[model samples]
Target: MAIDVGIIQDVETLLKNLNGYELLSYAICNEECGAETYEWLAGRVEGILVDEFRYLAKEKRKHAAELRKLFEELYPGMKPLEFNAPPLDTLPVCRELMKTKELENALAIAMLSETIGRDIYRKLQRMSGDEEVAELFKRLAEMKEAAYEKLLKLYEAMEK
Candidate 1:
């Protein structure tokens, strides 16, 4: 598919406008959505894939918790944002992959989502003026890259 430069620019503008708390809240929501998606997948897939999904689910939740902690520290008494709706636009793509109940589809979605996430985090890191927030975003981008590589490896293995 062709890259949507317009959409990318729109998202960049949105990210640039977000304050520290808003950025952290957005990250937390994305992590929670990811955790929920993986947990749902874990219940559907069997054998080794189930275990892998469960691990991914756990890691996603951990990411959410870490982001929440940071948000709390930054905004002492404020409540963290709730995951009441789809966090990111790609979340529906994940839901579609889950509905398909196909390992290949799930793996493909994971790879795509991770790449998008990494890019977003990199952009956020660069746009952030706060050193701590920038560092956190950089770390998140690195983690997303690692996850993307893992998903790509799994997808390739399944193709063979």
Candidate 2:
């Protein structure tokens, strides 16, 4: 459950340097990609894990919607950036772990992804010039942290 401080700091620095529009675009793309990933994972997992994966997928979609709403409100006529395909390297390992029914490995991958996402949102929240946008990022970061914590707990229980 412990994320590397160096990675977090690096990501934070990168996010903080973005302008408001760039930050919003980044958030939209990140949320959409996360939603797609979780949905795909849900279909691939089996048994009791299926329900949990589905729930996470639903949550990710909701996160995307929330970000979209905020983006629209902030920049009324501006179109949000479309989600680019995530890196090919990104979820294949998790898919392999799931295929082998390696629950702990799959959950570890998910937890790490969520931790990085949380740190990005946390940085955005701190550096955002607009109060409302900053608040939204704070909430988004909290959601990511909650998801990571849930996965970590499940991983620990599985290990036991």
Candidate 3:
């Protein structure tokens, strides 16, 4: 129930220090996880909500592909550092959302996850020294923002 500001700060610090390859590696993993989560949610929901979740899953996969292409371009011939442990799975909210049967709760948690992602991309954009990398992050953040808006609309419509 209680959120630890300290852990959040520590994670931010860790992300800030990561090299381009490392950051992208984590990002790729995150996108893959998001797609999988969305697909899982789609299976649990009914009616139009299923389509919305599938759409989100497809978008996530697209983002992952774009990130992977960028990663390959930036670090030609070098493999992205393998992410042994994905931090997204460890997030309390993500864990809780996975177990939740309530559609409203799932939607809220998904929106929150997207918000966190957008914020992270914005932060990375600000911190990156490379112009190309920064621009890519900015674009990714914008895309995430769009996805968040769609999720917000869905949430509002469900509430009506």
Candidate 4:
């Protein structure tokens, strides 16, 4: 008795075909860029909130100490997401998908940060396997849930 196990995993092929960032960034950017105008305050608001999260992650010096370092290594910028970024006062409606790579790259980065935030709580819950930390994860998850809700509201506004 034998089984025909003809299975192969092509790592390089998989990597080449993977638009991991593109897919995720597209989701994040389109959520905002889908707006009637990127100059629209909605996109700008969400962008700023996302930036604030990056700051918090950087400042969490106790438990999540290495987060900022890893963030820098993975992406080395202030996300070009200024607290007071260039205004959209007179710019034409940026109604098209990002034409150049820079905007798309920035969006990809934004998605990555959101993703890491999601992972942190989820991972803590899994790794806790105990009373205290598990409870902490539960609390953290709820926090994330609220943040997601707020983000959805912004996205919904963008949709309008």
lDDT of 3 by residue, 81-111 (tens): 7665544523536566667788887788777
Error of 4 at 119 (Å): 4.5
- Span of 10 residues, lowest total lDDT, candidate 3: 83-92
Model 2 segments more than 4 A misplaced: 1-17, 83-101
lDDT of 1: 0.76
User: Which residue pairs overlap in candidate 1's backbone?
Assistant: none
Candidate 2 per-residue lDDT over residues 40-117, each given as its tens digit: 776766665677777887887787788889888999999976535451223334444345445565677777777767
Cα lDDT over the full model 2: 0.71
Clashes of 3: 0
Alpha-carbon local distance difference test for all models: 0.76, 0.71, 0.78, 0.34
Residue-level lDDT of model 1, residues 46-85, one tens digit each, is: 6667887788778888888888888888899998655465
Deviation in Å, model 4, residue 55 alpha carbon: 10
TM-score for each of the candidates: 0.83, 0.78, 0.87, 0.33
lDDT of 4 by residue, 57-127 (tens): 33322222232233344446733121221112111212222332343333433333334345445544554
Misplaced by over 4 Å in model 1 are 1-12
Minimal lDDT window, size 10, model 2: 87-96
**Candidate 2 TM-score, true structure as reference:** 0.78
What is the alpha-carbon lDDT for the whole of candidate 3?
0.78
Pick the winner on lDDT between candidates 1 and 2. Answer: 1
Top candidate, metric lDDT? 3
Candidate 3 residue runs with Cα over 4 Å from true position: 1-7, 87-92
RMSD to the true structure for each prediction, in A, is 2.8, 4.0, 2.2, 15.2
